[model samples]
Target: MLTLNVVNKELCVGDIRIVGVSSASIFLIGDTEVVSLSSMFDTPPESVIIAPFVPLPTEE
Candidate 1:
């Protein structure tokens, strides 16, 4: 399992079943879940992509 401390308040945890490291991005699979974390070659990412398969409930 791989864990990343993101922004000090949030944590990005995933089991590294496999890693496809390219010159562009790093792909990971955790507990039947797949995610991609990438850094732009020219620009930085303003937002990260969260997999829809992982759900977070909204509060009303």
Candidate 2:
């Protein structure tokens, strides 16, 4: 899975007060995904980004 840290410093889009979400998109260039991180409360997140689907790597 993609991580939020790859995009920005925080877990949300705008300020923690306003509305935004932890979102990211995966692009398959070299089998790598470009992720963007942000957040939402009870509702779903906005913005539609698309990319290839790859399984998350398992930890040793």
Candidate 3:
């Protein structure tokens, strides 16, 4: 059993610039009662490839 409550009177913002946001993420400005975020990145042993060394040609 769980109970949550949130009350906000006033909120103001001028300018907000965000470049990038990745994975399990939560971007909030005002108010929040409860927030839960979880991220899991698993790379297996046999899930990787290694063998490449090619340089790009430069402009003359």
Candidate 3: misplaced stretches above 4 Å? 1-10, 42-60
Best by TM-score: 3
* CA lDDT of each prediction against the hidden true structure: 0.45, 0.41, 0.60
Who is ahead in TM-score, 1 or 3?
A: 3
lDDT tens digits, residue span 1-60, model 1: 786553434558765333233334444323434465554444455555444343335445
Model 1 gets an lDDT of 0.45
Displacement of residue 46 (Cα, Å) in model 1 is 33
Q: Write the per-residue lDDT of candidate 3 for residues 1-60, one digit (tens) a residue.
A: 466666777888898755544433466897766777565547875885533433435545
Residue clash pairs of candidate 3:
none
Give one digit per residue, the lDDT tens place, for model 2 in 5-44. Answer: 3443434334323123224442332223444557556644
Indicate which candidate wins on lDDT. 3
Question: What are the clash counts of all predictions, listed in order?
Answer: 0, 5, 0
Ranking by TM-score: 3, 1, 2
Total clashes for model 3? 0
Instruction: Rank the candidate models, highest lDDT first.
Output: 3, 1, 2
Deviation of model 3 at 20, angstroms: 1.8
Q: Give me the displacement of residue 19 in model 1, in angstroms.
A: 4.0
For candidate 2, the lDDT comes to 0.41
